[model samples]
Target: MLESVLLAGGGSAGHVNPLLAVADELRRRRPDVRVVVLGTAAGLEAELVPAHGYRLVTVPRVPLPRRPTLDWFRLPGRLRAAVRVAGQAIDRSGAQVVVGFGGYVATPAYLAARRRGIPVVIHEQNARPGLANRLGARWARAVAVTFPGTPLPGAQVTGLPLRPQVAELVAARHRDAGRARTEAAALLGLDPTLPTVLVTGGSLGALSLNTAVAGVAADLLAAGAQILHLTGAGKADAVRAAVAAVTRDARPGVALRYQVREYLAEMHQALAVADLVLARSGAGIVSELAALGLPAVYVPLPIGNGEQRLNAGPVVQAGGGVLVADADLTPQWLRSHVIPLLADPDRLAAMGAAARTVGVTDGAARVADLVEGLA
Candidate 1:
């Protein structure tokens, strides 16, 4: 009976991914239901939403003016126009429910849905709810949150939704880790025999992460663990140079098979092959690692409202991952802790199991249920 629904959000993977997951879930539940996405041309959604075969209705980006400038004075008019555009899109799509995942477009979508007397389902993905969701939640007919402690009105804890490929890897991760690891290693051209540590700073790369992990590539390789480091596109050169330096001063016969890459199209494979991961504690990264039951060292970005740290807290408490301050992720600490941890297969397996216990792979289904209720 659900005729149509609009999923609103985008900008980053954190928002867009969940929106797409909900979209996928809705269609899976009822293939006849029409699902549409509302996002700005600037955000990641412009490319991803279209690529995913969803109908994307583009809206002009009207960022909430923060500075005391001319843009601040023009906020009212811009917001009004965006809301009008959203309302028009809603009418055109005949969307019965507007599900919001929080971004620039979310505000207008929330307003438009609220004005049209349509049910609004809000999904807040971060422990620290973003501004758009903070305001939208007040009017949301139903509210879902990825983290339990997220300070939002009437929020039900629905964990971050895993992508389809991630779900497949999670299944493989449970069915046969050894087989998965071998296949993944082969897919990525990595050494299946070696204990592997996957390092990623994110799409743009983290300067702190690249520098610290690159400095310790030799130490890790020497400890019998190879590094599959995704150094972001721009940071790859620096990482390559660092690896070369380590190779030059290497001990007698230590052949460091450290792989440095700009990016990996198949991240699921990376997750499958890795014994450990060192990365930023973004919602998507943390959730994927948890779902796959991969142990990790989460270095929360030392910026924003400390949300990244909060995001990694639950994982750390479950013994699935370790959390370290950005300033504390030195080569010495990595050698002292990571090397010892890598050597202990029992501890690593225990951590991975604990991570699986805390992770919720069926988050998209849960969120879909909430949206369906609104419909």
Candidate 2:
């Protein structure tokens, strides 16, 4: 077994969270292992890595420009400096193997590890691999991917490494799903028996998703279904206003059925109580919902390289979820499709069952096993 590991990734929660998950699993499995994280001071890891009780070494943030810009010309010098620092950190940690989660820091970490003749392991969270991982995969000792058909050479489908809260929730659901949902509902102040729909666009919020869902809040409440709209940060007031405008002349009880919050600290709690989720189909959320066997309506972000759509493809094709384009997710779409689906418990149950078939709960452990094999 490896005595120490150097974990590299950061910038966003998508990379940092999974890197931490794998680190947690490694520590849990081998208590004596030394785990060190390499990240940039500007990234989420500067805050989260230390909070998780791991040693973090930071290198300058080096972004590889996509278009031919002046920064592209300066890439080699910046990358070399980053790699030099990365090598020093690796040597100090005496890492037996380096595990990378594909972010700005990964290229330097991979090159540094290779220079020292250290084995490198990579974990790609998206179906469409990022530039860093795509480059690292060429020489990585092992490549683990969250989704099937990821175009990485010698990649293994290890699933996304879930956060601890999500992993625990998956275990609880496996033990007794109804009981778990009820307990989680109680904690979240939600009625356990209500058919609840969770609408979110991740932490930054999606204006399109919020507007579309808010436009149909009254209709959902009228169908005896409740709404838990997590309207990203700084966007709740707008959603609230939209819902209020639609239901102003209607029943007094309508407002009581709609809940709007900017964010939930414990998102797994919301996931546990949610019967169905309508949100962006990012790799993290998609894998988390699938792991819990909750049906979802995936709205792929209109931006990016279309990776969000690719991430939701497997679950949708498996009959576990529905995919809608961001532009097409209007009020009419919700009234036409979502309301009726909420009313049909049998169909909802079937969809959840199908989702479970594609879910993976042991991803962290699988990735850890792969890392251990390298040493």
Candidate 3:
């Protein structure tokens, strides 16, 4: 049996979902192929990979802090542990090819594959390469990217691989517009007459996005707009509390409404119903928004290493959304940009059309073709 190994660990949905998309494609193309994902015991992969009916081999968790401190000393031990775990996992799986999807887990997985004389491929999901992928690039036999202009050498720009639900939404575009709208609204429990805006900052949530949404909750309610907010697990309670407080003060008969959750199980429903979105510019989120033809206001995370800012550029240039600096994401700016669009149906529709133009729904198939060619 042909086997493949995937490296994905220690991150939110941004990291896990792309790996799942590619894995789904791989299974669709080759039913008998056995796929093993190398992940940490603590990450989303532990649950997500197994839930998708694939085996997940646990590797050591070696997370690097965004800022350097005394913890830097732990790096050597962690690296050693990761290398050992990765080597064992690859050997046991008898992997013909190992693909690193960019994370600490990937670093060791790629190294173990190299030492075993197995071919290695790296997939980068950002416009700017991450630290792990940057190092893995040197030994990678093939490199795939989600955006143009990434600095990695010999990389092929394959766009972002979207989940199957998203692909179905794109394919269903030919149906009657009103029917699509009704279906989406019914699925999301939204009032068909009012406009809807989706607010999400990756799967883990962003404080900046949550804060801005809280401050503007009243205004959105007053304008007859509803919200579907996904607050990361860490900040869900705080965001829900703030929204409840705002909703309590809202005037009677105003259609200001919200459905707040820590993580959304029905992202397809939310995306389909949304007329506008406020989110971070993570490559995966950007790709999804574009594919769904949803207009957005993107706030790039201030932490530079995540490379979120670079991910927002294409949609901003395409007039599909506005890119806001994290520090500058105040309630006033959000109100100015979002309220006007919600009030103007024509402009909102235009932005949605522009967003659809930038989407590459065939990204997974393209990347799968490349992988097949390599074999």
Candidate 4:
């Protein structure tokens, strides 16, 4: 009997995407329930939330200061201000429950919701739970985690919620794999019959991924494989030049098969046509690939808290995907490993099937069910 819910998360797509997915599922299940989003004006949610047709209420960005600095000294007043606005938003929306997805806005939203005696549910997107979610989990009505071993008390493994497009792709692929591939290939100007490899380093591009994959583009092309390389932002020119340098002496029409784009608005089409994926193993992409039953070579980013590597560990162990270190993904590595995998259709299909076993496509529905029970 939930009349309204406030979904809180922002700063990155990893947070906003899942929040939106759960919001969509909640709306679909209970059309009359009011859905409102709480985010910072500076985060990606500012643009994406409104575009998704949700009512977005914003608060001032209040990043937690890790060390003693000006920000740390000012944190108290800033947090208080943010919490005040969050409470105002909760009151205005008449939110019966607050759903937090772990970002700067989450801390304040959690505080506000708890102070108002409203229930809160949390969804932690990463294997390593963030500070916001760590705090929220202390008294959340229910906790949902994308990765199995995420250290949250009383957390249920619900997997990452897939975007509508990705969920639709999963359903379509399930209905008819070959027809789905053909239709997606036509949309992306790819040949459905040819083995296709998708290489991406996220929206801003990964230097290690782009350089290593581009260096080996000719090897992949020579193996009768087509590439849909989404070079992030301005990295395409450099990748195109590297591919040209490597394949200059190759036979004609081989270069045509190497399509390098800066970005793709419809990512599901790219996912639909890919037989294998070579990319960074972010939580979102790892969950998406698993849900779609796509085999992948996950090159974990070398930076951060090493969560990317941890994120890919379970799927790799399950024989669904291969985890490669960022520094280890060289041209020589591609020649030794990736090229042969691309040539083996049986192995690719087997790996795809294995990935499907670890994936959960109904994560949004699961989270919605949790919300409904608590609300």
User: Which ranges in model 3 have alpha carbons more than 4 Å from their true place?
Assistant: 1-10, 64-77, 174-177, 234-256
Candidate 4 TM-score over all chains jointly: 0.98
At residue 327, candidate 1 shows an lDDT of 98
RMSD in angstroms between candidate 3 and the native structure over all alpha carbons: 2.7
* Candidate 4 or 1, higher lDDT: 4
Residue pairs whose backbone atoms clash in candidate 3 = 204-232, 221-256
lDDT by residue (tens digit), candidate 2, 222-334: 89988889999999999999888877887777676788999998898899999999999999999999998999999999999999999999989998999999999999999
- Whole-model lDDT per candidate: 0.89, 0.93, 0.80, 0.93
| TM-score of candidate 2 relative to the true fold | 0.98
Q: How many clashing residue pairs are found in candidate 3? A: 2
Q: Which of candidates 2 and 3 is the stronger one according to TM-score?
A: 2
* Clashes, model 4: 0
- Residue pairs with colliding backbones in model 2 are none
Task: Compose the digit string of candidate 3's lDDT tens values, residues 174-276.
Answer: 4555566678888767776778888998667898889888888888887889888888878888777877787775666443367777887777777777889
TM-score of 1: 0.97
Query: Which stretches of candidate 2 lie above 4 Å from their native place?
Result: 249-253
Q: Which is the winner by TM-score between candidate 1 and candidate 2?
A: 2
- The worst-scoring run of ten residues by lDDT in candidate 2 lies at 249-258
